[model samples]
Target: MRLYIAIPCVLLALVFAASGIAGITRGWVLPENRHRVRRLRLYGWGQLVAAVALCRQMLFSTVLSDPDTLDPHIREWGILSGGALLLTGIILMGVSQRARGARQGTGTP
Candidate 1:
């Protein structure tokens, strides 16, 4: 269904964004291109968050409709996996913000 396309899209995006960040950190990027890279990272993160939310919502709807039919282990795994992904994405945003702040020379206490 929609997930067949959505999941891979998100995974591919995340991989691409992570690699882009690595490239930037290693000075592969030009000084003037910093803002563009930051924007791309934010867009990638938003896509990832939306995809996770969509998955969690789908699982919730499915589980509630046939709670007894689906395996309990699956329900547990889905909840855990979705939650972890959401949290990780949020934390990555925080790290990204810190990096941006440092670049602006306003990150120090």
Candidate 2:
């Protein structure tokens, strides 16, 4: 079960991180709003952070199965940091999405 979850998490992390790097370095993925450089960077950073948090959560799950192998304090910190990053990333992405939608006249403000 953990393996199944881990596989998808790893794949998503890779995709998001790659997209983030491309967006930050070359602005490759923001085809719809190419003019919004700041928003693009924000979205990219959000994706990167989200990817890291996802990987961290995946690692935590794996470690949780064999709790004796790792320290409890470390696991606690991992969960805290992962949750915080995930939340922050999601918020940034949401803001970007909302801005894009408003610009496109989607009435998403």
Candidate 3:
């Protein structure tokens, strides 16, 4: 069960990190607000960091322990923190995409 959850999280983390890197290097920007590029880059950085933290908590921390033997507190903290970061990364990415689309007149809100 944990493996199932971890697999998807790892994949998302990779994607977030990759997209963030591309945004940072390529300077993804909106036409309506050139100054907003800085905010977008910051969002990218946030997503990248959140993704890394999520992956670490979900994959590395959980992998070594037997489910039965794992401490509840550790498991709770890992899941809580990982989930929070994952949610944050997803939200940031979504906001960036929407901002881009809105600027491009793609009807995104």
Candidate 4:
């Protein structure tokens, strides 16, 4: 059961980190409009960091004991912190996007 859950968590962490790095490097993270998007890079980096932390927690828990029945505290903290970080990164991205949109719509540049 734990293995099943851990597998998906790790996969998601990898995807998040990869996508975040791609977004930062490719410069396609923002909208098509060339308006000011504050903290876009920060959000991307945050996602990457969050993904790393998540993976670390999962790995640590797995190493501490049998993957099938790891420590509940570790699992709980990992899931909670990881989910919060993901949400925070996404919210930052959204805020940046909204800023860009506002600038574009208002012709503020």
The most accurate candidate by TM-score is: 2
Candidate 2 residues 1-109, lDDT tens each? 3788888878989998998888778766656656554477778888888999988888886647577877888888888899999999888776765544446576778
TM-score of decoy 3: 0.54
Between prediction 1 and prediction 2, the one with superior TM-score is: 2
Rank order by TM-score, top first?
A: 2, 3, 4, 1
Score each candidate by Cα lDDT: 0.55, 0.79, 0.68, 0.67
Q: Rate residue 12 of model 3 by lDDT.
A: 85
Give a tens-digit lDDT track for model 1, residues 1-109: 3556556655665565555465544534335545555544554464356456546745544433366766777776776777777677666544544445445566778
**How do the candidates rank by lDDT, highest first?**
2, 3, 4, 1
Each candidate's TM vs. the true structure? 0.44, 0.73, 0.54, 0.52
| lDDT of model 4, residue 68 | 62
Provide the lDDT at 2 for model 2: 72
Tens-digit lDDT track of model 4 for 35-87:
65565676677667778777866765554455566667876776677667667
Model 3 lDDT vs. the true structure?
0.68
For lDDT, candidate 3 versus 4, the one ahead is 3
Worst 10 residues of 2 by lDDT: 96-105
Q: List the pairs of residues colliding in candidate 1.
A: none
